[model samples]
Target: MKKFNIFLMLIFIFTTVFTACEDKIIDTTEDKIQTSIKVTHINIPYVYNVTNESDITIEGKGFEQTDSITFIPRGGQGGGTIKLGIKTIEDEKVALENSPYFRDGEYEIRIQRGILDQLLGRTFVNRIFNASIPDREGMTVKGTVHSNGQGVANVIVSDGIEFAVTDQNGVYYLPSAKKHGFVFITVPANYEVSVINTIPQFFKRLAGLASATEIKDFELFPVNNENHVVAFMTDMHLANRNNDLTQFQSFIEDVKNVYEEYKGQNKKFYGITLGDQTWDQYWYSNNFKLENYVDQIKSLEFPIYNVIGNHDYNPYVSANDWLGAAEYRKVLGPTYYSINIGRVHYIILDNMQWLNDGGSQGVVGERNYRDFLDQEQLTWLAKDLSYITDKSTPIVIATHVPLFTNPDQNGNFNNAMENTSELLAAVSEFTNVKVATGHTHINYRNSPAGSNVYEQNIAAVSATWWWTGATSAANHISRDGSPGGYAIWEMTGRNQQWYYKSIGFDKDYQFRSYDLNNIHITSATYTPSATDEFKGKVAGYAGEFATANKNNQVLINVWGYQDNWKVTVKENGNTLPVTRVRKKDPLHIISYEMQRLNANAEPTSSFVTVNSAHLFLATASNATSTLEITVEDEFGNKYTETMVRPKAFTYSMR
Candidate 1:
């Protein structure tokens, strides 16, 4: 119904000549006779530098000396309408005394009712690209930020070391050394560049010498993404190993389904991965890397905005940490930049500082990296936010590393972000701020009391690096037992709600329950053929499930649990006692760890189950008593399970 209203509003929106009321911008049209005025085209220059350019001419026929025109911002963001005096008006063309662009976006031109009889308030404002930016002595790269054959002004272009803003003609020239081998744009609001195979071509790859001049223009498409949704895909370690390619196909299907679902609702759907799209260790050995990743993600429906994870760096570069991202910048674009989508502002960053000490060509490095926003990124973020006058606008920071530590059952965590305070201080002015990160591959949220920032450490698409489910166990799961999945963020205006979408499950599949009475994982039961050297590790991994527990305790794993979500359990229509407990999911332990041990292989430490706070323990009256469990997510989505007594715990249990 809401979507239908939007369509109706678009169909019947009234636009016309202005009214005499100076303070109020009229919305209704005038009922006067129309005039025949033809505008061949407006000749706003291809580029304009503010220092030397000021006047912009509008071409066409009908012109009046006292015509009033106003430039109104799209989305009602920036400010109100901007008005300038008309220098000369003629039937052929008119020149306006224009000033520097105070804002960056698409604006509408509204003329006084009488001046434009038939065509008054419905025309789009032509942007004037010109600033007084002087050219450096030696300019190596030049480019234009254009859309629909018109130059875009105030669009920032950078070559890693130096930054330049487009002139009145939408032209930018950087006196760059070409060290980064590419020039990328910040991607101004309301416009997007070309996307090839789901990749936004926001940056151009430099082909020649640093001193040679290069011309690269960025073309953007105008879109109304005010009502859109973003799917946050993180840590999909697709390295062509462990049947990850096959597993990724299933992920693609899930994304296609989501795209269709949102498309039906008239919402613009987009996908942004929060890094670790490929395993660097297997870049050479497996002959699979970011290029392979691009091919895999090509099947996705929306344009892919990427974040550089720690594992995405070159295992061969040892000189500088940022140098490791040379390939990433070449393939994906800027390591840090900002883009506006609708009312929300998004900032993509590369927080991982790669430090592969022993790295050399053909020899993989340690692949070690620290997690924190570098000083350069912090500085860029501040400048980006300064343009956003509305402090209440939603700001989403997408990076590879999370700002907070993994919390236990009670939500207590230790050893948080390395530079959380500094990063937070940069965004302290914003009222609505959210930080979305991957790396942990576990689902958790941290919102300190009295703090404005809400950090949600999302789950991974390749659950446990595509291990458990790839095997005969047939269960794709994360370290916290959250199903291998991505997050679906629904943003309409400033109101945003997100859900963790487990692959092959409905949106309501928010939690899983285990009949603890039947969950007894003995070494002889799960891994009877374990080698003598690794047989002792079974009990260490199984925890309480190593022994029998017939206390009628039912364990529930709400992997997507946020602090505000509710959990309730009842037996025979009567309420049962429920306690939130920090426990490793028994099912994951049996699926990943036991499977590895049975094969006489050491379990990867990172793939093992970790104690999470999303677990809930409920006590029933007897072994034969039935139980009803219902979990409610923060968004009020309810997931319930009615379990009969003596429910069996098996490898395939849901």
Candidate 2:
């Protein structure tokens, strides 16, 4: 009986301890769930008058009594940190008030629970001029949309929620609440909104308490034509220095000249800089002033759009890390917006995310990184796409980072969109989609296997980060041997064609070649072999000549090589197929190595060309008299260049 009692007690104690442990685990999990807050909806007006304090209700999940809310101004003047007073808090609802001195722009709201934080929502606050009190009925906001002083009908105007269409006389009227903030337009197709002092003049601000109706007018530039030509330039990295501005102005002149050259082709010219308009570090030091750059860009005859790059972030003002883009919003209107020109819908996205850590130079207060589109942006994109009822309309997505890219030499992805697969899935329903990006400073085009979308990664305007002018080339040449340039894309209804235009070079200058004298080539393809000495050489001869042994080889780097493109070499009038090679441009390698060897050499390159996927190789006997290289791009543009067989040059191998 005594033994039985002891065993039963032991079992009971064991059971008690196990139950307590399980309870503890359950408690920890419940706490985690409570801290994982998510915002579902916000009952804030799209626009709030700056003169009045507005009440906003935030509805979300995972709210605790200890939680607090904050409002951070996004862009424009009168922006700083303003904590909202939470009048009430519930499990699903939190009511807060905006500051009386709120700014005239978009504001970001955030929720803080202990050490955990999350973005609650965003609202736009504006200052309206000559406003009045509302009668029993709301006031009316009227606007007229015109193109080059001529009325344009069927234009959609809105106040971020209610929309109105312009009449035959190009006039639109919308009922506005007494506390309305801004009256904006939807920007009709084949037309561009006017920009004043770098601010897109698509909206009219309403301010003060009044009793009269508001009147605003908007002008859009027409771009309707058979051939619509748009320029894609990226990574200007304009510093505050005069030299950088000079280079950028020169590039702008080149763009103007290109427009002039094609003026007689019945093409309408428009240009957009993909991103990195200004290096954040320099701009921040200059007190975030952009008047000069804005003036320069505005001087362009054609309408030019801007994209938000990682380097264009504003980090000094806001305490919230994600609010670094506030300056960009102030300087440039909304960071992400869409416009339609003819049959193509151009969606500009802000994918650069600020890390809050110090930048590369460690001078800028904050570090900005790429490849993230927040939830708010995703929601906006879905809504924007829903308005496009015509599924056949081609879509052009322009961003700073590439949505899809080939892996680096180590078989790893670099500087690509983090949510690429998700983004692609969202746009998968669209048949014709082209993504244009700039940041890699190399020109590349590829179509993912099953996506059927062509992604073009353009070279930087400030080629090699403004390092090319000191090299022997003395031009804006990227590390990939692609000259710093922009791309010209022509859209005709649903069909599109594009080509990279080097700033100073003619359109025909697409590729460069090197002749290798008789070196034993055993590989059937020009692809870099593990045993090939030339593939690893980086400090040998410069320019288009390479020593060969028993195998006479010809190497080529087609800067704009696409899958549909083909390269063929005719040796002594005999046509021979050229094999694609994974090798770096010999010119880039030599230039970089020479600069490295001589410390006194100017910093003429930012990246070394390690391996190029667009390279090609062809081999022939030493007796071959001449070599004629022919390249045909995807659009059936053929370019041929002939070179005389040169005697083998000797140089010490690296």
What C-alpha lDDT values do all the predictions have? 0.79, 0.67
The weakest ten consecutive residues by lDDT in model 2 span: 520-529
Provide C-alpha RMSD values for all models, in order.
Answer: 20.2, 19.4
- Candidate 2 lDDT, 130-171, residue by residue in tens: 234333345467656777656688776655445667788677
The C-alpha stretches of model 2 lying farther than 4 A from their native spots are 1-184, 195-200, 203-217, 221-223, 240-242, 284-289, 315-322, 358-363, 407-415, 471-473, 517-550, 600-606, 647-654
Model 2 TM-score is 0.68
Q: Candidate 2's C-alpha lDDT? A: 0.67
Best TM-score goes to which candidate?
Answer: 1
